[model samples]
Every structure is written in C-alpha cells, then in structure tokens.
Target chain A: MKMAIAKQEVRALSGDEAVAYAVKQSDVDVVAAYPITPQTIIVERFSEYVHNGEVDTEFICVESEHSALTACLAASATGVRTFTASGSAGLALMHEILYVTSGCRAPVVMAIVNRALSAPINIHCDHADSMVERDAGWIQIYVENSQETYDSVIQAFRIAEDPDILLPTMVMLDAFVISHTLESVKVLPDDIVRKFVGTRQIPLVKNHEGKLVPFKLDPENPVTMGPLDLYDYYFEHKRQQEDAMQRASQKIKQIHDEYGEITGRRYGNGLINPYRLEDAEIAAICLGSTAGTAKTVVDQLRAKGVKAGLLRLRAYRPFPAQDVTKVLENVKAIAVMDRSHSFGAYGGPVFHEVRHTLYDAATHPQIVNYVYGLGGRDMPQTLIHEIYKELQKILETKRVKKPVRFIGVRE
Target chain B: MTAKQKGWKELPIAGLCWKPSTEYFTGDWRTFKPMLDEEKCTKCLICYIDCPDVAVKWKPEDEKIEFDYNFCKGCGICANVCPSEAIKMVLE
Candidate 1:
C-alpha cells in the first residue's frame, strides 16, 4: 500500500502568522527573540501560542536580538528544536552570533522577514538583511509568499536537523510584501506536521570516559561547547562549516522534495523556480514577492508574442550555481534584479553571483543588473516590464551598454 | 598538537574544550603564594569564600584552610579580603 499523504488545511494567514504556526507545529522546544518591524509579528504570534497553552515551548523574550540568538544557540546546543525571528536591525544585531551558531553546527532555524538596513531608519522590505549575512554559512531559502513561507519553515527544520547538514537555516520572506500581507495558505494538519517534522536527531559524541553519548549539553556526556580557539584550530573549524554548507544544497532539495511529497506542493527543485523560460529569449531573475509580480509580467509579455521569462531565486545561499547555469543556457539576454546594493562592487550581490555562475557556461547570455526597490520602494510591474524591455534591447544589440542601472528612482 | 592540522572530522565537535581544564596547569603563572598564619586566622573563612579560582581549600574538622597551589594563580585577592591578615602573600 502506498503511504497516504497528509491533508493540508487551508487557512488565510499573513506570512508572519504562517511562520509562527509552522514553528508551533514543529514541536519547537525554545523560541527566543527580540521584536523588530515586520518580524515582530512572527515572535508575537508564537508568544500568544505559548501563552494560550497551544504549544509547550519555552518562549524567551530576550532583551536584545544578540541575546535572543544566543539563547536559541544554547537551547539548540542541548539538542532541541529552536527558532527565532528578526528583520533588518535585529539581524544586524545578531551578526556576531550568527556565525557562532552555524560554526557550532547548531541547527537553529530563523525566519528573517527581510527588511532594509538603516541610517535614515526606514522599516520596509528589502533583501539587505539576509543578503549581508550571505557568507555567514547558514542555509538561506527565500520564499515568494505566505504559503511558501509556512511550507519552507517546516522544511527548514528537516534540512537543518539532518545529520549531514546540521547548519542553521534562514527562511526569508519580504517585510511588508509578504510578512504583513494576508493570503490563503494551505497548512499541514497538526499531527501530520508533528509527524513530518519529527523529533530532533542529535548525533552521538564521545564523553570524557570514552563512552558514546548524545551530542548536546547533557550532564552525562559533558562536552564543552563554543570554546575559544585563537589560531590553533579556528581555520579548521571554519573549513568544517564550509564543507557542511556545500553538503546543504543537496540536503535542502531532498528535504524540500520530501515535504512536497507529503503536502503536494514544492518549489522548482527547491532552489530556482523558473517561469516561462523554456523558449524565452529574454529573462529577468529576482527573489521574494517580486517574483510573483515578475511572473505576472512574464505572462503579460508572452501574450504579446514577447519571449519573456522569469527565474525566481528561491535559495540564495549555497547558491544553485550549476542549476542556474543550466536553466539560463538557452536564453539570449538576462536581467538580474537586486533589491539591495553592494556599495562599490561590480553589481548587486545576486547579480554578481548569477554573472559569476554563468561565466564558465558553454553559451554566455548578456546579463545586466538592476538595483531596484531599495528602502521599501515600490517595484511596479511596469518597472519589471521595463527591465525585460532592457533585456530585449541587450538581446538585439548583443551587448550591455549599461551593465548596472537603477530602476524607478530619480538620481 | 594544534587543531589546525586536523581534518574536519578529526576536529572536536563545536571546538569543545574536551580535555579536563586541569591539564592546562595554570598554577605556573603565580608570582606570589599565600602563606597561612594559623595563630592570626580567625576562622572567618573569608579567604575560602573570596577566592575566584577555588584555590583555598577548607578543612572543616580542623576549622582551617589550605591552598591548592597547583591550580592557584596567586592573585592575592584572598590576602586583601582577610580581616585577620591570615593569608599573607609571599614572593615565590
């Protein structure tokens, strides 16, 4: 007999609400967080669940985002499922321990409601928050909407807790674009979610007595965690983290497919969600909720006999470079959209990665970068259409006259 | 051997301080050692309570204290806190 898939319960929820519900169902043992815009709703909703006796979780409202991550790190080290949520400033505050959490191989899952970093202090959607931590060694999955946010949160636990890929994972949803917007999301049933996420699978480590014990903060096993190492072993520890990250890309796809098998929903291979790229000459790449708008534009352009396509990047870190190269090989010209800038770099972070990934491709497509939607600025479908128009121009000219351009904003 | 030379798997999980800390033997850093004067000691046990290193060992039966010189860094905080002037820091 075939294994029967769990029935998904359809409920209308905001991105933050969906994430909190997923965390509740995952049997998370600890949630420590400090509130910030967009992400505040996630922790706030989870706290209500804890207060109403809906979940038996230790909800720690930490004083700072740093302490929040530290608390989650300590709890996760004890081999329990742990979670936290934060946005721009909050994520920046947790920067130091972000590496510490992943470096210690603590599978602490975080929902980063992507928001712009501040100097003028704006609370809005942007990839700047998670993008800044791109090199921090955590597995990153950017979701397009509330449904994907909820589903990714559940899958994140499985991927992070896998023994071969015990690194922290960040499930990113755009701030106001997804986090604050309500949509109908199909959530897995409570028992089904519990069974699917399962229990934490901690590996065994040797104790001082040479006896094997579960690797955690166990009294019987007594293993020191996060010890200071100057140069003697620091490099080797970092190398170990990178090795785990390299292993994570495949692990993410496996877990994503496993979840899809259960719920009947999956992003394209759990990394790159390509739309209308099969016979397209011009394509635009983006992430988060903007992909939804871009997909609409792709359909609109297609009706007019324009071979326009969109590649919605679902996973940013441990970038699916080979997969991206393979998918974009036949395209003539491509436009990479970035919600965040890289200061003085060649282009935005995502654009740079896509360009580099295609550098060794058998067929090179003229790629251009558009740094748009900074500081929660609106990305109208017209602007995305203009991006495609620029790609069309590049295709006709066979060259990128302006390699990097800003969209919609007056200079 | 330093951890840099080890393979990723060979390195201890999470850079855990696996070996007992006693193996490091921090006592060699001591420049001064505390000398106990039994007659001057009031049995206040101030030295016992104030020591950060747990270097001061108490003998409850005899109502006196002893120093474990092996682990003590000999910071002389005990001598400063002693009201009875029982623990006098002497140059090693």
Candidate 2:
C-alpha cells in the first residue's frame, strides 16, 4: 500500500523551525523551555510568536531545564496543553521530572533535539540523550528530517493527549543533522492543525471517596495530584503507565492512519518506516537522520543488483518489537546501527532490543551491531555502504565475525 | 497491599489523590487545641489571618473567631499569632 503524501505549500525550514511552527499551529496553552544548543531555536521561535501576538500562549523562560519541565508539569496538571524542548545535559538535568511528568500522566509534549551526553563535553548529534531515558515512560518518536519533525510534533500532541494514553511524548531529531539542516516541508494550515489536535481530553476518574471527578487540578473539581504513594499503591500506578504504553502502540498507529487520511503523510504503520525491505537479502536498521543516509545507500546498492533495504525505527519508546520481528524475519543478514552506546552492555540499546526481538522469530537473521556517529561525528554514505557490505559477507558465509563493531571510531 | 492485587478497577488514574485534603479530619492528630480566653480576647482578628489551616472561623452571632476543631491540626500557629494572648494552646 502506498502512503498518501498530502499536497500543500512547501516551506523551506530547518527541523527546529519546523517544530516551532508545529508548536505554534498546535495552539499550545503554555511553553516552558530553557535554551540549549539545537534545542534553543525551537523555544526561541515560539517565544517570538507569543511576543508578536501571532498565537496566544504563555511563554515561560525558566532558570534551568528542571524548572522548565516543572513548569510544564504544573501547566499540564491544570488541564491545559503544554510544551517544552531541550537536548543533552539539559535533557539530563530534567531527567528526574521526566519520570514525574509521565507518572503524573500530564501528557506534556516536548521537542528533543537529540545530542551527545557529556564526559569531555560536546554539543553535537547523538542518540545518547534520548536513549538514556528510553524507560522513562514517555512516547518517543524519532524523526528523519525537517518534514517528519514538523509532522511528528503535531501527531505527538494527539497521541499524548489521547484518553487511552495520557502520557507525555518527545519528538526527537538528530542534533544539528536534522535540527539545523534546512529542507523543504509542507506545513498544514493552522486551522487544520488546530482541528486535528482538538481539545485536550481530561478523563474523569473515580477518587478514593468514590466520586467521579476530572483528572486535573481544578478548583471546582478539587483534585490532588502527585501525592506520595508508598507500598499501598505505587506499583499499581506504574502498571497503569505500562498498560498505557501498550495501548499507545496501537493508538499511535490509529492516529497516524487518521492523520494520513487528512495530510497524506504516513510513517510505515507509525512504528517502523521501512524502505524496500520486501524480498531483501541484506538490511540495516537505524533511527533519526541516519535513516535518510542509509536509504541513499540502499538506492545505490539496489542499482548494482544488491538486495539492500532500510528500516527506520520511528517509535523508539514502544520499540515496535512485533514489526521488527515481522520485517527482518525473512532477511538473510541485518546490521543494527546505534548512535549511542550502552557502555559495557552486549550492544547498544537498539541493537540489544533488536536482537532480543528477533530471538522468538521462526527464522533468525545474522545480526551485527554497529555503534556509529557518536559526538556529532559524520556518518558518511561510505560507512553505511561498508555496513551493508559486511551484512552481505555475513549472508554469504552465514557467520558474524564480530557481534559488535565501532564504526568511524578509533579502536 | 501488593500492586498486582490492586487490579485495573482499583488503580488510581493519573495519580489523582482520591481524598482531597479537606476530606481528612486532621483534628484527631492534634495534641493540643487552641482555647480562646474571651475575657482577655481582643477583636483584632489577627488569629483569623494567621491560622495556617484556615481553621479559625468568625462567628457572626458572637462576633468572635472560633476554631473548627474538625480540620484543625492544633499546631498553635493561631494562638501564637494572637497579639493579646487571648488564645492559648491547651492539652486536648
């Protein structure tokens, strides 16, 4: 089945600008953000819109990323749509509240310009920032370029605020690669976006007193949020979040399908964005801007009669395990590229999950993990080609010489 | 109780505290209750503004402030805030 790519006016925009425009069009009630590399432009642009009276939004420039998220939590608890953005250390600083936001089920939308986490201190593209928080209970959607960044931000609000899934979501784009790189993007009119996002759905829940009340901080309803729960009920609350994530996987696909009907842009089933994976002997799986690069390599290899394909993991939090198993089951060999390393683990986060997902499959493909593009290092087309060549070797010999290899990094 | 046993029906949706603070009668926790000495009492109403819990209520018939013992924790903040020493914390 072909995706309906919507016809609209194309605007030249960087990924950051695209996200900013989406936030603007979303009619967000509040934006609480702190400036960080790559992520700075997003809140900055939105603040300008707030300043010029282009949109009605409460723009809060907080002292730290922690406060920025705290403000978002407060605003979200008040039953209003809220947004924020950060990267690298900024995201790390807000790590504690990230859990609070989801645990509280605030449904805050955040734009994450993915950047390398610090040791020696670097501000460039890497998945380390978002990958570290993979288990934070937030719905994570990684984007390929400016267009996807724009599209996903709008969809994120719908997905997050869904009654079944009252969870926060982050739209992650590779730092600089997609965040700063300019591309042509078709932006939907503000009214269309406003109608699509609609009003926030704050479900009524029964409290301890057995009264049905709005699940928000309202004076009339008088509900309390973020109370200390010990052994009596904390675990049940976590399970609620888990069930929400499972429901989210299905809801995300549903929202994407409905969104595609209007906008004509769809990511492969809203989980895995696959390119020419059918009848392929070799394949590579990655996320973010690298997928675009890998697809280019796929096209080049296909011209030479090599069966190469690409799988871009659009939704990372849910992991899309079933889709990965179904798509990669037939391939002879596969390379899982990760922009972040898992320290001393067997492989990077994506690699480990991909390998684990394939274990229960009827057919197993020779899988190799390649740790690449750390610290904003360039992932040239040649490196992606080399990975496919390595996959080809594995197919011919039916062996994986190295389970995990560092790509473009000195040993 | 274990979380697994709580079940979906019993789970609190979005962590909303089911019991609003007002619902809990904290008066039982009080070790000392504020006793007003009407003879020495001044009609300043300073105790009304200084009561942390808003437990001090103004009686229209008496034209004096009376504490609502149902919600009062008896922390003695209102007694201390009383300038005329008209109110004092007494053992419950």
Candidate 3:
C-alpha cells in the first residue's frame, strides 16, 4: 500500500546536523550527551535548539559519555523519548551501560558517528566503535549518506519503542565522510515527523501489588528496573532479549516500509539494500559510507558487462542473515569489506558473521574478507575496483588461497 | 513451597522485577545469625538503624526490637553497631 509522499524542504546539512534535525522533529523529551569529535555537532545543534526554545527537550551536558548514556537510560526508564550521540572513545566509555540500557528495555535512540578507536589517537572513520558492541543487544543501523542518516534516525525511535522490541538503538554514520561532509537532505516538516514517530507507548506490567500498571519508574507504583537476576533468572532474561532482537528484524522492515509510504524513499527492505545483485555473477558486501563508493564501482563494472553487484548491509545487529543469503545466493564470488579489523582474528567482524551465516547453505560462494580503510584511510574507487578484480580471479580459480586480504594497506 | 518459575515468555520483558525483593529469601544465604538479648536492650534502636538489610525490626509502639531472620543475610552489622552489645553473632 503506497501513500502520497509528504511535503519536504531541501536543506544542506552535515550528517551530524541531520541527526539533530530528526531528533528535534521527533519531539525527544530528553537529550543527554557529551561532545566528541564528529558526534559533537549533533548535540551542539540540538543544544542550540534547546537554548532558542525551539524544542522542549531537557538538554543535559554530561561530564563524560558514560554519564550521558546513563542519564539517557534513567530518563528513558521514566517513559519519555531520550536521545544521545557519541563516537570512538566516547562510545567505548558507554560500553558497560549499553548492555544495561538494553537489559532494562529502555528505548533510547543514539547516533554513533563511527570513528576509529584510539591507540595513536587518530580521529577518523572506522566501524570498530560500534562493531565491538554488536552483542550488546541494541539494534544497530548503518547509513550510507546524510539523507539516510536523517531518515534512519527517525525510523530508529519507532523501531526501538515497538512494544514487541524495546531495545536501545544506535544509528551509525561514518566519521568525516558523512558526519563532516555536507549534502542535500530532504527533511519532513516538524508536524509530519512528529506524526510519524508518534508517542512512545509504554507497555503494562504486573507490579508488586499484582496491579497492572504502565512499565515505567513511577512513584505511585514503583518497579525495579535492571534489577539483580542471578542464576535463577539471568539466562531467561538474556533469552528474552534474543527473542526481541529476532523480532526487531521484521519490525525494522515494517517501520522502514511505513516510513517509505510517507516519504516515498525506501532502502531495499531496510535490512539489506541490494544494488544490482540480480543476475550478477560477482558481488561485494559492505557497510556504511563505503557502500556509496562501491555502488559507483558496481555501476562502472556493470557498464563494462562485468555483472558486478553490491549488497549494502543496513541493519547489522539483527545481522539480516537470511536477507544476505538470499541476495548473494546466485553469486559465485563475494568480498566482505570491513572498515574495522578484529586484531589477530581470522578476518574482520563482518566476514566472520557472513561466513557463519552461509555455513549451512546448500551451495556456498567463494567468500573472502578484505579488511580496509582502518583509522580513517581513504578507500578510493580504484581500490574498490581492485577488490572486484580479485573477486574475478577467485571466480575463475574457484578457490580461495588466502581467505583474508588487507586492501589498500602497505603490508 | 517455592512458586513455579516463570518461563522466558512469562517473565517480564527485560526481567523487570515488579515483585518486592522480600520475595527472595536471603536468610538462606546466611553463614552467621544475630542473636539478641532482650534484657541487655537499651532501646537505643542503633541496631535497627545499622542493619543494612532492615532485618532488625523495631516496633516503636511497644518499644520492642527484634530480628526478622527471613530477609536477613546475617551481615552482623547490627551486632557490631549495638551500643549495649545486646546483639551477638553466632555460626548459623
């Protein structure tokens, strides 16, 4: 069912500004954040909104990222929409509470400006910040551009707050590439965004007194959240979280489709957005802004009758294993690009998951991992073409001699 | 008798504990128990104030202080804090 696209205004905004715009229009009740590189602009812009009285959100400037998400978690527990943004070391600081927020079932929406974790203190694009938290039980969405960043941030709130899946969500945009770069983003009017996100519907739970009340920290009817569940019940709660994550894949698709109806813009099923995968003999799988570059490469390869395709992973937490399998089933050779590499591991994080996902398939493609662009390195078009050329060699040879290769790196 | 343990689906989402903490008997974990001597009690209520688990029950109407061992972990804080040394800790 298709609905008419809502009227929108075109604005040149950076990826950070796009997230702020979406949160501002979503009528977020609270925003607690600490300014970090690339992610700082998001809170800076939102703080301006708070100062100008543009929105009624309580903007909290926390001392550290840990306190920022901790405050957001507490605020979200009270049944109000909350938001925060962080990256790199800041995201690392919030690592402990990331699990606590999801375990408490607080639907706090966060924007992660993906940045390289510091060893030499480099502030550049990488997936290490968010990828490390993949098992933290939050719904993770990676966007290709500023426009999708704006659209996904709005969709994230609805997806997280769905009663069937009350998990915290983090929308990731590449640092510098998307966060600092300006692009034309079509933003829905405030009222339309508000109407689309709607209000957070608090589910009812039985209280201590056996009275059914809304699931929130209410003084009138108190309930303990993030309480101690030792051996007697800890495993069951974890299982319940897994259940919600499984439910989130379908919920994300549903919400993405619903948003598409109003905006007339949709990524491929909101899980895995396939670009020219149909009837292609070779394809590459990637995440974040790299997809934008890979798409151009795929188009170029297709022009030369190379039958090359690209599969952009939009949702990573739910993993979208089924969509990935279906999209790359016919392809003979594939490349899994990782902007972040797992030190001393067989391959990057994405490669491990993608390989494990296809282990049970009837016929598996010759899949290889290419760990590239770590610590803000540039992944030019020529490098992506090199990856495809490598895939072509793998297809002809029908064997993977070296399963993991680091591209564009002097090794 | 222990109530039936809830299955994963029946458990509140995210393990929200709506039931009071008293439902779990912490006394079973006690390695030591606090014994009170009513004659040595000075009614200072210091033990009641010091007990972390609120196991030291104080009935102000009758000026009676007693220990509710059911919820007590037998931490011995009350025995340590008792001004009159009315409470003593012994192996349970």
Best by lDDT: 3
Interface DockQ per candidate: 0.37, 0.40, 0.61
The positional error of residue A405 in candidate 3, measured at the CA in angstroms, is: 1.1
**lDDT of each residue in A150-261, candidate 3, tens digit only:** 9999999999999889999999999999999999999999999999999999999998777898999999878877777787789999999999999999999999999999
Q: Evaluated with TM-score, which candidate comes out highest?
A: 3
- How much of the true contact map at the interface does candidate 2 reproduce, as a fraction? 0.78
- Winner on TM-score between 1 and 3 is 3
| Window of ten residues with lowest summed lDDT in model 2 chain A | A1-10
What candidate 1 keeps of the native contacts, as a fraction, is: 0.62
Question: Model 2 residue A36 lDDT?
Answer: 97
Ranking by DockQ: 3, 2, 1
Question: TM-score per model for chain B alone?
Answer: 0.77, 0.74, 0.78
Please give, for residues B1-90, the per-residue lDDT of candidate 3 as tens digits.
Answer: 236788898888877885777786667678899988989999899888888888888898988898887888888898888889988899
Better of 2 and 3 by TM-score: 3
User: RMSD per prediction, one decimal?
Assistant: 5.8, 6.6, 3.2
In order of TM-score, best first, we have: 3, 1, 2
Q: Determine which window of 10 residues in candidate 1 chain A has minimal summed lDDT.
A: A204-213
Which has the higher lDDT value, candidate number 1 or candidate number 3? 3
